[model samples]
Target: MVANFETVTSGVNLNQYAGRLEQLGPALDGIGAYAERQVKLAIAQGRKLSGERLAPLSPNTVAEKRRSRKARGILRRDGGLLASIQFQRTRANEVQVGSNLKYAPWVILGTRPYKIRPKRKPTLRFYTADGWRSATEINHPGLPERNIFEGAEKAIGPFATATIAAHLEGDL
Candidate 1:
């Protein structure tokens, strides 16, 4: 038998896998949206993506929130942080979910103990168990680590498998 075959260097087909591979980009897009929704949902419920309940708000915090007309939920105030959650698609299979809000890190890792004083006013006025009080300066205990966003990021690991499988199957 005599045969002639031209050397091929491109347009290689991945056979049956090509179709699924093509679906990956769209899959990642969906995954990012899905992940963002999951994180926001977890936060709205005042829990971590791991289903861990967030730390309870201090009495002072609750009282102040009520008086200031802010949402009285843990890790929630005026809904800015929740609305700021975002996801960026960086590659065919990679997406990054994060926030541009400056205080997001503080929500994730908390803060060190510090003094809180009025910058413009002579004293700080806030509510407490004993009712309204005024102070020139107050020692604030460091906030407890919420880590809700981090927990959601971690939980997405398991979700990635399911999401990809669903995407490939056109079920996502």
Candidate 2:
């Protein structure tokens, strides 16, 4: 009696898995949009919570005269910076989100002592509750740092995990 033994090897095909990975661009785009919206919402909420007005005007104490038209506020009056906030796919698997405004970092982190100068005249004149006053140099106390981005960043991990899970489960 003769006995023979044979060994066989099997290979797994990963083309389907590769195809699924290649098709993740749209899903990643969706996640990026979600993150951008979430961050924007957080910033808006922070603005509301901080009681920051869209345009704040200086007080006028004069009995018959109109108050000086001075605008104040972190939010843009023209909606340019707010509208410029956006997210874009920087790479095949990467996304970048931020505002295009030059003053965005200053608004977020605030500034130190700065000088305030008159726009037109040499002397800075303003009408306060006390009375009208003129100042050669005004020291401006910078705005307090608002943690809008920090708040949004805290939610990113959960948002990404849930979104990816849903996508993989066909629930997204």
Candidate 3:
């Protein structure tokens, strides 16, 4: 006598998988928003750290004294540059955090000695306690690299990983 066995297979509907895949866009949006917040916080912390690293303003001259009084700290005078730092998502997978300050790059990456030409060709004058003083053309010694932007970038990797993991697990 010969015994025969029949094999049975079950059909799987892949449409459910596709449906879950479709939810990925919205999930990524949520994660992007979360990452943006994390990055902004990192940048703020970096700004504080950068401020601490800067050289203190000297109160030698009257102008310097007045500036010291009005300014919060070294690079944070009037808080213009620091306040300009902002974050925005440019694409689904891209986020940019930066400042609109024209000198931001110069601050981040130290520059070499460069010539200075004022728009006023005849004479450059600056405010002083007594009156306007004639400014002389002098090669400016560049600032040292502060690494504030690097600090912010370094914080993003771990944050992105954790955030993505949490999002995948539905904990985000």
Which candidate ranks first by TM-score, i.e. highest? 1
Error of 1 at 57 (Å): 0.7
Runs in model 3 lying further than 4 Å from the true structure: 1-68, 125-133
Candidate 1: regions farther than 4 A off: 1-23, 166-172
Candidate 1 lDDT over residue span 77-125, tens digit each: 9898889887777655567776778888887678899999999999998
The stretch of ten residues in a row with the least summed lDDT in candidate 1 is 1-10
Backbone clash count, each prediction separately: 0, 0, 0
lDDT by residue (tens digit), candidate 2, 1-172: 0011111113645453455444556666776787677656655544531234222322332211344432233443445555666777665556666777787777656578789988889899876667778998888766556434554434565666566555555565
Model 2 TM-score, 2 decimals:
0.63
* Candidate 2: clashing pairs of residues: none
RMSD (CA, Å), candidate 1 to true, equals: 11.0
lDDT at position 85, candidate 1: 84
| lDDT string, candidate 3, 1-172, tens digits | 0011111113745454444433445445554455445534534454422234444333333465474486534455566666666555454444555666788777666678776557757656555556556655645565666545444434455555555445445565
Top-lDDT candidate index? 1
Single out the weakest 10-residue window by summed lDDT for candidate 3.
1-10
